[model samples]
Target: MNASVDTAGAMAPQDVVNLARYPIGDPDSPERAALVKSLRDYLDEHQYVALPDFILPNARSRAVTEIDAVSHEANHNSSFRNCYLSRVKNPSLPEDHPINIFEDTSNWILAYDQLPDSSPLKTLYHWDAVREFVAEIVGEDRLYDNEDPYQPVNVLIYNDGDRSSWHFDSVNAFTVTLMLQAPEAGGDFELVPNLREGELDNPDGIRAVLEGKGETPVPVAREPGALCIFRGCTALHRVAPVKGATQRLMAVMVYEDQPGVVGRPDVNETIFGPRVAANG
Candidate 1:
């Protein structure tokens, strides 16, 4: 079998050669096939897909509570602002460069690679079900396993007024954002679909929209349990600042190719540090 999977997510005959050793999708069924096709079509033209209540119905509540608890803990334990994987500072990039941009306080937090095995978020360390789902979507034989993995878990809890600026993923793959809870107002997810064909192209066009200089970008409002898969590498996207008194919490599942790997001194140093570079 070939290693390539088409937009339909069907593997090429050549990839079938190694199919036995590599499990693709799980609980392979007609429903799963339909879900795969829907996601593919959505991304092919629009660069995004929303699977409402994507987690198995039975697991939905647990996932929500678990994510919320983690959000609560991170808010109290780490820097008041964003918290990501620990990494070294980048001297190569100019201090003013976007790569070097770091917030003094962030609304983001890393869920993977946490210390003290019993931490609330550690359940994700062995979240086999979630790992399998992501692998199938990315057509990877295995989930990323470096540092944290090409695919890592993160939780963002935006308490009133928190917002993530517009930016593109530095890698060549997609990022999945699952909303666990949303504020009463604001906190909408916005994107310019398929803007990035690949590579490290900057998504200034999408930025132009956010700046009110271009056409309106597509918006996806993530309700509780809404799982959105976005080609962050190509699509320009951002979260509107949170509004209302409630917190807007989301679980971001990130994935990239092996080639897009980067080593840093501390993961917590960058706003998007856990993002691996595209394969050379």
Candidate 2:
């Protein structure tokens, strides 16, 4: 199927995305096909793809302002634990094992449910063209916006003394993230590409990273407005601590291959504070 603009015609994909650089609105367009192929190839090779300046400047600026105004409404939490973001201890593992070792400070998060109805971030996530483009690039027949209101989208805010501990996202196959604001120093997105593949566990590899003795993780240097598509299920990644006064803000766009998938109530409470009644 040829990728086309949204049926609603409210905003063309070209206007929201940088069509001149990365054409993806029209699937019939050679540029769009080539871009999708390249992105797929990159993901297949490295388990992730980073698109710099994917969002246009005006739209990005507006989104940043809108998010900043409501930043205070976000929930915050801190934890010390392994890469999976879980603090549970496995009695079978050694005390010094990576699974048991805790490093890095707890980072703050701003849940997406807090955003106002008119938030640009929400609008962008619901765009049909954007969803279609992402589905095509990820080789999914179709993608649906997450049914879980709180887990559907969010912003990770890293303030001073805030950093995410190394963790793997085994829950989701792919993650789409955008940088809204960056701190003056630190706050680099680090990843050990393909550290674990398929269902096979790489205990030694995970240990090496936890012990700081593994291959140097690659640091993704991204500017505001950069879009990153990551296969987090296999690639272990984390955000370094924020420094200076500026806080690091990132938008996470969540999607699912099937409908009716909501986040676990316990997990949702941990990440997004209290949960509201499920959407009808």
Note the clash tally of each candidate. 28, 3
Residue-level lDDT tens digits of model 1 in 176-272: 7777777899888887776546454443444445456755778886667567877776766767778888878777765444534444535333433
Q: lDDT winner among the candidates?
A: 2
lDDT of 1 at 92: 86
Candidate 1 residue runs with Cα over 4 Å from true position? 1-28, 56-58, 67-106, 113-133, 139-142, 145-151, 199-207, 256-263, 269-280
Model 2 misses residue 141 by how many Å?
1.6
TM-score for each model: 0.64, 0.90
- Candidate 2 per-residue lDDT over residues 196-280, each given as its tens digit: 7787778788889878899798898689989899898888888877888898889899999997788877778777765443432
lDDT of 2: 0.78
Candidate 2 stretches greater than 4 Å from native: 1-14, 275-280
- Minimal lDDT window, size 10, model 1: 77-86
